[model samples]
Target: MKTGVLLVNLGTPTAPTAKAVKSFLSQFLHDHRVVDVPRMLWCPLLHGVILPFRSPKVARLYQSVWWPEGSPLMVISRRQQAALSEALDRAGIRMPVALGMSYGEPSMATAWEELKAAGVGRVIILPLYPQYSVSTTASVFDSWARLMKKERLVPAFRFIHDYHDHSGYIQALADSVRAHWELHGRGELLLLSYHGIPQRYQDEGDPYGLQCHRTSELVAAQLGLERHQWRTTFQSRFGREPWLQPYTDGTMQALPGEGIKRLDVICPAFSADCLETLEEIAEQNRSLFLAAGGESYHYIAALNDSPGHIQLLMDLVCRELA
Candidate 1:
């Protein structure tokens, strides 16, 4: 039976420009899973106010972290796709692995077409988000549903929901931390930061925050980290509405004054380094922490395309195939 894998990630702008960012954000923010506000109020506010004023500023943020080849997210995601394919080959599995972005280029339709063209009779949807949220994972599901509804010959498919406490994933995270400590020595505090969703979402039964805590706890256990040695926080909150807190910015700003002078931060929610991990945590938060009296700040890179991470992905696919 022909089988294939569809690796999906939150999308990125095609270019670091207001025009492009606006287009990207329009589709991303408009998703009901993302912004639960009624379209009557949300559409005008999103287009007339937010995008008009925010896109240029956001475009600059994208530019700051943009790789020469493309956005960091897209570049890292592509590398991950290639690495996963190689890992599957090593495991004696021949399958086409294609990438789909939830909102933009290399879209779901394109990825689905690639697999269909390969004569795949079965497809596995592997969303890159390890800790699932309606905003991320569900959005991918919504896109898939839309795609399949128009298909007369939809392939048999399965979706991997969340792997927050996957043993290999925790080990890979722990290994990365150890390697970083080996090079730069250990920081006084290790912060596991994940992207934040609105508090209402959690109240509405989203498991994202809970899974993030589980991921952090598992990694901390794997690394033999004491309670005081590590912490968990949330980042990339949008709008004025409350989000899952210990807001990363506020925590970073307060930590130094609380006598935590040196810190190491890692974003586990992101499988690949992107705007949030690269610019927001590494550059912006680093500066914020330093300004607030932090003496040392280190942002650990994500597990993007690492050998261990590839192995983990391959294991996930193999498990599903079995």
Candidate 2:
């Protein structure tokens, strides 16, 4: 059977506007995996309160980080898709790879359509999330499942659940950090911040929290960072529920008091820099840390289409095909 790859990511708003943000959020938040609150209780609150109020504010945030090409996430994801395809070509591998967003244009179904049109019969779904959460990776699986449900000829599939501790991934992350430190000077503390899911999710036996810490430990070790030099935290939490602790924002505020004046932050959870990493970590969190008496804040960019990252993707694909 002819094989193909699908690179999946959580999506972005089509435009940096209130209407677009609302539409994106409505589909995103409405997902059962994301917001497990009972639909009966959540529906009214989501539509009547959150969407109405959050959309404009979130749209403004998106606007702050919007690129001329598109939202950073969309643009960088496309670059990744292209880079991986080229890498496969250079490796003499024959496979069609397509980009899919879980919630927006070029959606997961559309990606499948592209691969199918390319004469693919077996699919490899590689979600961009390094740490698997039902809220994220499983949601991508659900998209594939839905597409399969609609098809008369169901495609054969191989799914990658996560790659949080892959050697290549860890090496790529460490290299990115080393390069950043070389250019900008290493900070006193290296903060590896990942996106947080609700505490309850971990409590319910999700391995995401554990996988995130493992990824942090592996990358930090690869960078030769000592215990005191690096720490892991979580960010981009929603809905006021207790999220994985040592929240990035709170830690940023507290680090200055601990006399950690110089700090560097990186969001390894994101394959590509998005509003969360770019606007939230780079801009807002940096301001917060500085305002609270810190100095020399730097946000290391994500491994988006970088050579090391592209190599990591190439390795994963080759290994799977082998």
Candidate 3:
């Protein structure tokens, strides 16, 4: 049977402009999985207030991390696609790999078409999220289901859900931290920062937060970190609603006062260095900690297209294919 792979990530704007960001936000926020507010109230607020005001501000954040080629997320996803394809080929596995984004260009539909054209009869979908969350992984699955519903003949497919505690993934993450420490020296504290979800989500049995904590614990154990040397926190919280606590920004602000001046922060939730990791954690949080009396802050980059990351992806694919 001819097999193929579809790699998906959260989409990005075509450009770092207000108009582009608005368009992206319109689609992204409209997903019920993302914002559970009833449309009667949410629609007016989103269009009238949130999008109108947040777009310009978010556009600026995107601009800070935009690469000359394109948005950092899209750019890194492309590299990952190419790297995984190359790895598969090296293993003598002739699997066509296509890239997809949940909300924007080169979408799931486009990737499906590419796979169909390649004559794939079986496919594997691996969303770049290591941890499963309704907001992210389920959103990607919903997009795939919407596309498949319209198809006359759906192909055999497998979706890898929540590799958060995958041994290969944990090893790769630990390797990155070790490399960073070797180059810049170890910091006073290691902060494992993940994208935040609302507290209600956890109450609703969303295991995202738990998965994130497990991932951090595994990585920390591999690195032989003491309990006091590492911490897990959440970042990129939106709205005023309470989220998973020990908020990254607030923790960063307070860590310096507690004499944890030198810090190393990593976002295991992100597979690529996007606006969240690049601008929010690396730039914004770095400045916040520094201004709050932090002596030094190092933001460890994401796995991206690293050889180890590629191996991890390959291993995940192979396990399912087998």
Candidate 4:
């Protein structure tokens, strides 16, 4: 059967505007997998309070990091899509490789149509989240399932849950860090800052937290980092309620106070540098650390379309195809 690969990411708003951000956030935050609050309570807060308050502020944040070409996430994701397709082509694998955003344009439906147009009879769903969260990977699956239900003849599907502990992934992360340190100087501490899910989610049996830690450990080990030299933290916390800790912003502030003035941070959970990595970590957290007396702060870029990353994607697809 002819097979196509669908590359999925969490997605970003089409533009850096209040209307766009509001629309994007509305669909994103409304998902039960993401928020998990009872609709009766969450709906009122989400529609009345959170959306009204956050939309403009969040749009401003996106504006600061928006690329001239488009949203940074979307631009980079497109590059990644093209790079993976080229890699697959070089490997003599002729198949459609389409990009889909879970919450925005170039939706799953669009991607499926692209595949269908290419005469694809099967699909390999690859979510870019290295760590599987029900909020993320499963949400992509939910989208795929919904699309399938509407089709009179459903195509064969194979979904990749996560690659948190993949050897190629670990080595790519380590190599990126090593390259960063070689170009820049090594910092006192390497912080693996992953996007946070609620602590309640972990308590309720989401393996995301565990997978984040495992990815951190493997990356550190590949880099030969000592226990004292590396630490795992969580970033981009959403709500007032408890999420993963040590919170990245909090950790940044505390690290300066702890006398670790030189620091390097990388987000393992992010497949591309989005608002979170660019604005939140690079700009906002850097300001927080510097304001708290940090002498130097460095943010390592994500493995976006790097040779190693493309190879890793190519291997994943090849494995499934073989």
Candidate 5:
């Protein structure tokens, strides 16, 4: 049977320009799943106000993390696709692996077209989010469904919603944390920082926050760390809406005053280090911690194309193919 695999991630702007950022934010913020306000109220705020006002700042933030190659999210996601393809090939599995981004370039439609061109009879879609939520995972599904609606031939489909409890995924996360501590020496506390969503999402029955806590607990248990040694917090909150907490920046700023000097931070929610992980956590948040009297602050990198992560992803893909 001809099979194909598609990997998707939240995307980055095509370029670090206000025009590009405006276009990107227009699509991103306009998603009803993302903003949640009615079109009547949200459209004016997004296009008239937010896009005009916020685009430049957001563009600058993207610029801070942009590499010569491209956005870290896109680059790392492509690497993941390559690694997964190699792993599957070595395992005697023959399937074309295509990469897509939910919001930006190499879109879901393009990925689906690639799979169709390959004459795939079956396709497995793996959104690069370990934890599932309506906002993230469901949005991907919505895109997939929209693409298939106009297709004359739709392949048999399988989607891996969440792998938060997967053994291999948990092991990979634990190994990364252990290796970081082994090299830099253990911190006074370990902070498992995850991307935040609005509290309203969870209140409406999104399981993102709960799954994040589970991933944190599982990784800490694997490291044999006590409750005091590690904790989970959320980051990347925007606007005035209440988001999942304790907020990462707030926790980092408060930790030093609470006598937790040395700290190691990891963003479990992100498979690749993007602006949120790089510029926000490693750079901006580092300064916030240090300025607040932190003695030492370390930001552990995400599991981008790491051997263990690659293996885990391959395992998931193979399982789907089987």
Candidate 6:
């Protein structure tokens, strides 16, 4: 059977400019699943106030992590696509692999069209998020649904919602951590940090937080680390609302004072390093730790285009195809 694989990510700005950031934020924050406030109260607040005031600051954050190739998220995501395609070819799966960004360039519509043009009869969508959330996974599905509505012929479809508990995925994460420690030596403590969502989301039955903790525990167990040796935290909170805690920045800032001199941080929730992992965790949070009396701070890179990660992704795709 003819099959196509579509990989989607959260996306990044085309450029580190106010205009570009504004456009990116406009799409990102406007999603009802993201903001969750009633449109009557949220729409004006988003475009009128938040975009104007926050765009330039957010643009600066993007500038800090912007690479010669482009946003790290897009760059690594493209590399992942290439790696997965190569793996599939080696496995004798001749399928078209396309990358889509849920909120920016290489959009869902374009990816779907490419699959259609390639004469695919079945399409499998794999969002890069390891833990499922309505804001992330469901949003991807919503985009696909919209695209399918106008299609002359809708292909058979399947979605890989979350692979947090996948053995290959957990092994890939453990491998990355081990590789990092092998080169730099183990830190005084290892911090598993995932992106935070509003407490309201979890209260409303989001499984994201629970799955993140499960991934952390599984990875820690694989490393044979004690409970106190590693812990999980959340980051990237916005607004005055409560979010999943202990917050990553707060933990980093407090660790040094608590006599934890050296630390290693990893964001397993992200399949690829983006502005959140690069600028926020590696740069900003690193500085926060160092300035607050930390002797050494290391940021473990995300599993982006790594051999193990590619294999894990291929395993997930093949399982879905089978």
lDDT of 6 by residue, 212-315 (tens): 99999999999999999998999999999999999999998899888999999999999999999999999999999999999888999999999999999999
Q: Write down the TM-score of every candidate.
A: 0.99, 0.99, 0.99, 0.99, 0.98, 0.98
- Model 6: CA > 4 A from native: none
Instruction: Show model 5 residue runs off by greater than 4 Å.
Output: none
Model 2: lDDT equals 0.93
Separately for all candidates shown, the number of backbone clashes (residues 3 or more apart, or on different chains) is: 0, 0, 0, 0, 0, 0
The alpha-carbon deviation from the true structure for residue 160 of candidate 5, after best TM-score superposition, in angstroms, is 0.6
Q: In candidate 3, residue 189 scores what lDDT?
A: 98
Tens-place lDDT per residue, model 2, 205-283, is 8999999999999988888878999999999899878999989999999999999999988899999999999999999
Model 2: lowest-lDDT 10 consecutive positions: 313-322
Residues 104-211, model 5: lDDT tens digits: 889988988898789888889999999998878999998999888997877799999999989999999999988997899999999999999999999989999999
- What tens digits encode model 1's per-residue C-alpha lDDT throughout 1-322? 7999999999999999999999999999999999999999999999899999999999999999898999989999999999999888877899999999999999999999999999998999999999999999999999999999999988899999988899989999999999999999899999999999999999999999999999998999999999999999999989999999999999999998899998999999899998899999999999999999999999999999899899999989999988
Model 4 segments more than 4 A misplaced? none
lDDT of every predicted structure (CA atoms): 0.94, 0.93, 0.95, 0.94, 0.91, 0.93
- Candidate 3 residues 40-97, lDDT tens each? 9999999999999999999999988889999989989999999999999999999999
Higher lDDT: candidate 3 or 6?
3
Model 3: how far residue 236 lies from native, Å: 0.7
- Model 5, residue 283: distance off in Å is 1.1
Q: Which is better, 1 or 6, measured by TM-score? A: 1
Which one is best on lDDT? 3
- Model 5 TM-score, 2 decimals: 0.98
Residue pairs with colliding backbones in model 2 are none
